[model samples]
Structures are given as structure tokens and as C-alpha cells.
Target chain A: MIKNKTGRIFEIIFYPLVSILIFLIIWDVGVKNSELSVVMPGPWEVVSKFIQSFAVPIGKYTMVYHILYSLMRVVPAYIVGSLAGIILGILMGWYPVINRILRPLYELIRPIPPIAWIPISIVWFGIGEGSKWFLIFLAAFVPITLNAYAGATTVDETLIKCSKMLGASDGQVFKTVVLPYSVPHIFTGLQVGLSTSWATVVAAEMIRSTEGVGWIIISSMDTNNVVQSLVGIMGIGVVGFILAIVMRKIEEVLCRWNRIET
Target chain B: MEQDRNLDIILKCENVSKKFQTKHRTKEVIGNINLEVRKNEFVVLFGPGQCGKTTMLNILSGLEKTTTGKVFLNDREVVEPGPDRGVVFQSISLYPWLTVMGNVEYGPKVRGINKKVRKEKAEYYIELVGLKGFENSYPNQISGGMKQRVGIARAYCNEPDVLFMDEPFSALDAQTRYLMQEEIMRIWEKEKRTVIFVTNNIEEALYLADRIILFTNCPTQIKKEYVIDLPRPRDYTSDDFLKLREEITENMAHTL
Candidate 1:
């Protein structure tokens, strides 16, 4: 078993390297032949620009500054939004009165895109970090809430009865039985929320921000420095990838029982 | 025989009936049944499918309400499920996310027992059920039989006045079921608690019970009650055992 696990890990590590190498080769070749302007520089150019910017001062349109700015807005919004979503979702799912009172309002609001909230957010909070934070929160909240509600509502009745038979009170059963059982579904919501938060950060920054990766990309566009803009985009992808990997690792650790074959 | 009268009554069901109302019709599951389980006695209820055996057990455990009549636990009315009557369900209902120890400790914890005492109680029951080494293992990490052991241990840890088993071993394979019956018998001998076991298997009923209550099909009523006079460590091949099995089987065959 130990040997099999080791072999699996080795395969996982090597397979990604092979794929990345193939992707890079294709990208390099395609960029060399394409008539697309320097505005859309190739993968290699973006990498070199990323390295060159890092050689300069820390806050001078560098990869670190833009990435940190984006993270600052996205992380807090994601945390607050997801926490609210989970609490509300569990309540809505567990109590019929809450579900009946809140579900229609949720449905009405959920259809409005997070980006579409820009004008209202700007009017409410002005074009500062708050507007961007609100957009990111809006993006992360709906899916997490909906998924959590579905998870909590569908808990097995047999399990609940089993808990009661063993002398668990309603509160005890909800805490030890229902909550833990709904974790996989909650984690699924978190994964969606995390990814969507990242997707919305750029749009949020594009609408209202002055110092995030999205703002940096916009400034690069104004200056017609396509390579820098491409570097910013690549940096966003890499950061998102890293965040996803971290979330997956946490998911595996917390939900070892729910593991399934890929 | 005189000692039978000395035995305390742990559970009593007086004219218990259950009617489930569905959208289409109100079907009576159990019709006016009277039963009693004496303290430390291993009582088994046997019947074929849809015979309301499970419904009776559910009423005993306070998982379902009786449409008529009353159930008394140690002379008090059974209004809701409590730790005084621990139940081992047919489906191994150990909490999936909790480790074996966590599941075992759940009862005591909910009963307002302190952490140290609950842990000790859980540990004792874990060892009692022969699952000492797998305390930290989650439900999915264990086999079906092992999971059932955890379920049994969890119920036993609560130290209930009566242990209500709803076909606890019926889901297991034949060999495992037989082994679990012996295990349960051993545990019962040591614990000396009243047990109300429900099953559909005739052999299982014969093998385990001091008294076997057989039930008829839908709107189930007790058809016959047999007081087994067989000695302990009963041999299945013995003439007396065969004759008793035949009697019970013949009695059950006519129920449909």
C-alpha cells in the first residue's frame, strides 16, 4: 500500500510537468508565427517580464504588489461571504419558516450578476476598496448559500432517527450528526465560492479600484505594454491555481472519509 | 420458576397500536399488542416481512408514537427517546464522520456526563465490544461487522435499562450474523441487561431468546409466545433444538 501511494504521488508530480512543458512549447511556437501584436505577448515573454519586474523595487508595478492587492480584497470578502452563506443556508434548510421567508428574496437577488452590482456599489460605497469588496462578496455568497442549503436540507432521515434513538437531543443531533454530514456539500460550496471570488476580483477592480492586479492590467493597456498586461494575467492564473491547490489539500485533510477516485 | 416472578419488569407495552397516515390511506402497522420484557431477560420478537416487528421495536425505543395504549419503562410512561432505552438499529447507524470513540462517547456526552467520565465509559464499552484498537477509526474505515460492533458499543456505553435491537445482525452475512449472535449473548451474560431483539429469522430467534414472540403479517399481532427451556450453549444438531426449531417454523409458516 505504501509503495502504491508513493508511485501515485510520483505520477502526479511528473504528469503535470510533462503537460506544462508541452503547453509551453506550443505557446512559444504559436506566438513566433502569429501576427498578433506585442500587446498579446507569448507565455515566455510574460515569464521574462514577470522576472524583470521582480528585479526592481517591491511596489513599482511588480507582480507581488498587484497580487497582494487582489488577495487583500478577495480574502476578506470570501471569508465574510462564505461564513454568512453557511449560517444562513443551514438555517434556511433546517427551518421551513426561514426557508419560506428568505428563499424568494434570495432567488430574486441571485440572478443579478456581481458585476452588474458595480453601479449600485459605487453609489453606496464610492469607488474605493469597499466597492470591490462588495462585488467579490456578492460573487461568492450565492453559490455557497444555495449549495449549503441543498446539503443541509437533504440529510438522511434515518441517520437523524438513529441519533435520537441513541438519546441525542435535537441540538446534539444537529451538531454531531447533521453538521458533519453536510461538510462535503459545504466544502463543495467553498470551492465554488473561492474560484468565483477570484474571477470577480478582476472585474471588481476594473470597475472601481486604483491599485489591484486588474488596475495594473488596465494601466498596462493604457500604456500599450501588452507584455506587462499578459504578465499580470498569468500571475492571476498562477495565484488562483495555488489557492485552489491549498483548498483541495484542506478538503482532503478535513474530509478524508468522503474521498473518491478521480 | 419462582425466580421469574422476582425479575423486575423493565418494559411494558399495553395494547400498543400504530397507524401511519399516508397521502392515500391510513394503514395500521401494529394492532393492539401487549408485551413485557423482564429485567436481564433476552427476549426476541420474530416474524416474516412487513409483520410490524420493527414498528413494535420503534415504539419501545420511543422512535415512533403509539396511536393507542401506553408503553411504560420501569413504571414510567415512554413519551420520547432517552438514554434509558438504548437502541441498535438494523442499519449500522454510527455517525459517519465521527471516529468510533466519538460515536461511543456521544450518548454520555449528551446526557451531561463530564469528558473524563464519558471517555472512560466509551473506552470500557469499546473494549467490551472488542473494538479497542480501532477507537480512532471512522465509520467508513471499518468493515460492516466492525461498524455494527461500534454501534452496539455506542448503545451499551449509555448503560440503558433496556437495549432495544431492531434486527441488529440481520444485515450481516450468514457466518457473521451467527458470530455476532454469540458475541451479543456473551455481552448479555456479562451485562445482565434486558434485551428486546427483533428479527425475521427463525434460527436466530431460537438461538438467542429466552422467550420468542412470533407475530403475524400486516396489522401485526402476536401469534404465539414460546418459552424456550433449552439449556445454554445450545447445540443446533441436538434433537431437542431441531424439534423446537420445527415447532417455531411450523407456527410461523401458518401466519401468512
Candidate 2:
């Protein structure tokens, strides 16, 4: 088991680097050595342009500024939605009355894709930041609430009884047992919520935006710039990967006790 | 009033009977169990598997309601579970999310005890249970015996008048079970709290109990009782120990 764990640690360090190198090599060689280069730029040109856009202008804003704008849009909605989702989900799960009233409404909204909300969101809140935030909020809220609710609902009755035996009252049980018990579920929701926020933002920015990664795709298609479109996709890919890693690290720190299996 | 002030009688069960209602009929688990425990007494409720041992323990601890009787703790009727009757369940129910110290201190911390005092209290029990270095370790990081130790420490830290243990060490392997048995005896000698331990293991019952209450099978009642006058750390291989073990096993067989 120790050896296996050491091997896993080694794989964590080197495996992603090796796979990424192979992928880059394949893309560089295949694109450069093909007639496809007439319509599509080689990997080198797209990558260089992607890097240069950080300092130079892609359109109205540099890549960094565009990323900042997307972050600004996402962070607020994600925070608000996550807080609301966690509170509402835990409450609903604990109290039967809250569950009975809210469950139907939540279930109805849960299945609809965040992109589906774009038209209605735009109409309700207008084409400003409001609509985009609404879309992102919807993307984040459903999964967070669902997972938190699951965590709350599935709290081990044994643990609760144990706490009561140790002299905790109902409110004390909720604070100590119920809240801590639901945290892992809350983290699960956070991970899913983050990824969905990234996904929905692309769709959000696609619907009439000036300076974001999704705008790169939409504007590139208009101008027949496939290289720029590829660049937008790569940007999204890298950012999404980073976001996932960040969420995982945060979960590790917050749930250090929960990370290891019993 | 004078009789009511008998503080030495720590726990009393007055015709405590429990029944379950199945889909079609009423299922009785405990049939009119009347028992009393004095201060610092180590009572073992030894019974067969599938008997009402756990139900009886739960009823006594006030974790479950009796269908038609009452239990008194320190002369007060126990309608709800309180810190005064700490229970270590059969399944190791240590909160996986809390470290050893955290779990040990949980009872005190929840009861509004100040941090300094609770920490000291928890630390003392942690040391008593021989988990001194494992304070920072989570329940998952420890062995089964160690987890059971944490459960004991957690229960003891609450400073309960009586502790109810429902097969706390039954999940352990034979070697670990023996080791934990010795550890429990050592801790109990030091702490001197009233304990009601339930198990099907005759050797364990003979090894630990001040008095053993042999229980019958389904819809259970006390079949027989024996006072274990053997000294502390009673040798399992001793003639007296084996004799009692044999007699209890024979009696249980007859009753079953």
C-alpha cells in the first residue's frame, strides 16, 4: 500500500506533464504537415497568439482583462448562489415543511439547462450584467442545493443520537452534527457548481458580449478567423482546469479530516 | 423522602418493558425488566445473539422509550437522553470528522463547558484510555480497538453517572478484544463510574463484571444472576474463572 501510494504521488507529478507534451507534439506535427493549414493555423501560431493576447489586444481588451471581466461576472453570482443554495438546502432537508413547500419548485428548475435560461433571463433582467449573472446563478444554484440537501438528508441518525446522549439540544445538534455532516456534500456541490459556472459563462458571453473568451469564439466565426476560435477554446480549457484544481485544493484545506477514507 | 435520597442507587429500572409494533402484531423485545445499579458497579448483561440486549440497554440509557415502564437515573425519571447516561454503541460511532481529542471533548464542549476545563477533562480521559499520542488522529486513522477507546474516552469525558456500553468491543478481533478488555478494566478501576456493559461473550462478561445478569432469548427476561467475586484483572485461565464461564455457558444453553 505504501509503495502504491508513492507511485500515485509520482504519477500526480509527472503524468499530466507527459500527456500534455504528447498532445502538443501531435497537434504541432499534424497541423503543420497538412493541407489543413490553408484554412486553419498551426498549433504554434495559435499558441503564440494566445500568449501574446495577454499583453496585446485581441479586440477591445487584452486577454487578461477579458478574463478579469468573466471572473467578475462569475464570482458574484457563484458566491450569492452558493450561500443561498447551502442555507436553503440544509433548511429544506432538516425541516419537513420547508422541504414540502420548496421541493417542487426546485425540482422543476433543476433539470433545465443554464443556457435555456438565457432568453428568459435576458428578458427579465436585460442584456446587461444582470442576465449573465442570473444564468450563472442558475447554473451554480441547482447542484449546490441538491448536493447540500443530500448531505443534510443522509446525516447518520446514529451520530445524532450519540450527540443527544452526550447532552446536545436540537439547535446544538444542528450546529455540530448536521452542519459538519453536510459539509462534504456542500463541497461536492461547490465543485459541480464551479464547473457549471465556467460552462454557463461561455454561453452567457456568447449571447452578445464584447471582451471574453466566448466572445472570441463568436467574433472569430463572424470574421472567419478559425485560429482565434481555437485560441478561445484553449483559453476556456486551461481556465476550467485551473478552476477545478482550485476548488479541489480549497476542499482539501477545509475538509482535511474528511479527505481520507475511514 | 428519606428513601428517595438514596444517591448510591445510581440507576433504577422499574418494570421497564419495551415492545415494537410490526405490520400486523406487537413484537415484544424486553418483558418487564426490573433492575437497579448502585454507584461504581460494573454490571454485565450477558445474553444470546438476537436477544433484546441492545433494546434493554437503549431503554436503560433513555435512548429508546419503554412501551409500559420507567427508568430512573439518580432518582429522576429518564424520559430523554442526557449527558448523565453516556452510551458507547456496538458499532464504533465516533464522528469520523472529529479527531480523537475533538470527539473526547465533544460532550463537554456541547454542554457549554469552558474550553480550558473541557480540554483538561478530555485530556485526562484520553490518557486514561491510553490514546495519549493519538489525540490529533481521526477515527479513520486508528485501528478498531483504538476507535473503541476513543468512544470510551468520549463517553467518560461527559462525566456521566453511569455509562452504557452495548458490545463496544465485539467488532474487534480476538487478540484486540482481549487487549481492550484489559484496557477497559484498568480504566474502570481508575475512573470508578457505574457501567452497564452488554455482550454475548461469556469470557468477556466473566472477565469484567462485578455481577453478571444472564438474560433469556426473545422477549427477554433475567434468567439468572451471578456475583463475580474474583479479584481485579481476573485471570481468564484461572480455575474459578473457567468454572463460572462453564456454568454460565451451560445455564445459557439450557435457557436458550
Instruction: Give the fraction of reference interface contacts each candidate recovers.
Output: 0.55, 0.86
Tens-place lDDT digits, model 1, residues A41-130: 677767777777666532354667778889999999999999989988888998899999999999998898899999999999888889
Clashes in model 1: which pairs?
A: none
Compose the digit string of candidate 1's lDDT tens values, residues B36-108. 8888888999998778988898898888899999999999999888888988989887777778999899888
Task: State which docking tier applies to candidate 2.
Answer: medium
RMSD of model 1, in Å? 2.4
Q: Which residue pairs in candidate 2 collide? A: none
Q: Write the per-residue lDDT of candidate 2 for residues B1-256, one digit (tens) a residue.
A: 1232234888899988888999999999899988988888899999999999999998888888999889999899999899999999889898988999999999999999999999999999999999899999998889999999999999999999999999999899999999999999989878888999999999999999988999999889999999888877799999999999999999999878
Q: For candidate 1, give the DockQ.
A: 0.47
Estimate the lDDT of model 1.
0.85
Candidates in order, interface RMSD in Å: 2.9, 1.3
Q: What is the clash tally of candidate 1?
A: 0
C-alpha lDDT of residue A243 in model 2: 91
- After superposing candidate 1, which stretches have Cα over 4 Å from the reference? A4-9, A33-40, A56-60, A223-225, A260-262, B1-6
- Candidate 2: TM-score? 0.95
Determine the backbone clash count of candidate 2.
Answer: 0
**Poorest 10 consecutive residues of model 1 chain A by lDDT?**
A53-62
